[model samples]
Target: MASIVDEDNKKLYIFDEFFRKGMLNNELAQMIKDKGYSKEVIIADSAERKSIDEIKKLGVPRIKPAKKGHGSIMTGIQKVNQYEIIVHPNCTNIQDELDNYSYKKDKVTGEYLNSPIDSYNHGLDALRMSIQSVKRKARILTVKL
Candidate 1:
């Protein structure tokens, strides 16, 4: 997800995306360069440190590891949820993820858990990583009827 942030208004305008599976580091580097993001500071998943290093070496500048740890996912979810996210019409995958991402459900009583389901979150994870330093007080999500 490529975005422009409106910090004062707490808005995240996601304007572009490249969502493809099994892409190699070189391909990713080329994408960043082709998309004109060579100079931008990109926050990538820390889990892919080796890949990030390879991309950096491949000539895309300022690739930083995402800040992550225990409860980080939920924290990021809350942080992003506070903002009004505006997605580009062309970014269908992002729109789909935002619309479908949800909390997990309990089996026995069918209660919705606070934890978020892992599915449909790749783009969202990138978005969350992008704004790791930006903070917002978390609000508990209540399901709507």
Candidate 2:
């Protein structure tokens, strides 16, 4: 899973369900810890989907329930306000912007390379916010409502 938080203090956090067990969990936790972040400051937002053991293994601070028993568009947006940085997928519209960046294509067939099938809109939004945070320039495609 992932970690989400609320407020500038970064005291509140939301973590995903897969914080423990497999190598993935360890890696996820290690990534944050490696950056010198405490598990207490990180919360698990999707704990219901995963086992409690997995949640504890991550050692994050708080666990919040997912909205409407599942992740919804509104909840996803709400998550943005909770944390300083949000790393998610970019929506379909974002593809147009990313399209400008050349990706590897089939050299032999001369076919255009395909973008990731997964949604990167959220990640793009997060990245955009990060750029703005650093006083970098970026195109604003969507409203922050």
Candidate 3:
């Protein structure tokens, strides 16, 4: 859906979306590889195990899995809100999702739900997952060092 290159331009954060729907995992890998991001670290949804496996088969570098949970989602949302996440101008889907995505609400109580409506969330999910993974890895590296 969107990608953010770090200030150094060495790292790339790819937010998955349906820019072209029905694309196979291998095809997607090739497309990313062709774009010269093959060596960059890729943070992908851990829930999509099959697709992740397929991408792994292509030998993409540093394919990190992003764990999804309520806490992680909340944290990711907070991170996005707290920082300036600039998206590429060409990433229309990312812009659209950011604009239109909303939390589900209960009809009777008129209360906002904890989770987001699923329909327009692919890009958002990808972004959240990537943010979570980055945070998680940073913590790990800090602990290790």
Name the candidate that leads on lDDT. 1
Q: Over all chains combined, what TM-score does candidate 1 have?
A: 0.89
Poorest lDDT segment (10 consecutive residues) of candidate 2: 136-145
Please identify which of the two predictions, 2 or 3, would achieve the higher lDDT against the true structure: 3
lDDT of each: 0.75, 0.36, 0.61
TM-score of each: 0.89, 0.33, 0.73
What is candidate 1's lDDT per residue for 1-145, written digit by digit as tens? 6777777788888788887777788888888888888777677888888887888899976877888899988888888887898888999998999899898899998999998898988888788766774444321111000
Per-residue CA lDDT of model 3 for 105-134, tens digit only, reads 999999998877876667676666665556
Q: Which ranges of candidate 3 are over 4 A from the true structure?
A: 5-18, 136-145
Q: For residues 36-120, write the lDDT of model 2, one tens digit per residue.
A: 4533323233323463235346763332223333434334445443445432343333444344434356879977654323343
User: How many clashing pairs per prediction, in order?
Assistant: 0, 18, 1
Runs in model 1 deviating more than 4 A are 134-145
Best candidate, TM-score = 1
Q: How many steric clashes does model 2 contain?
A: 18
Q: What is the descending TM-score order?
A: 1, 3, 2
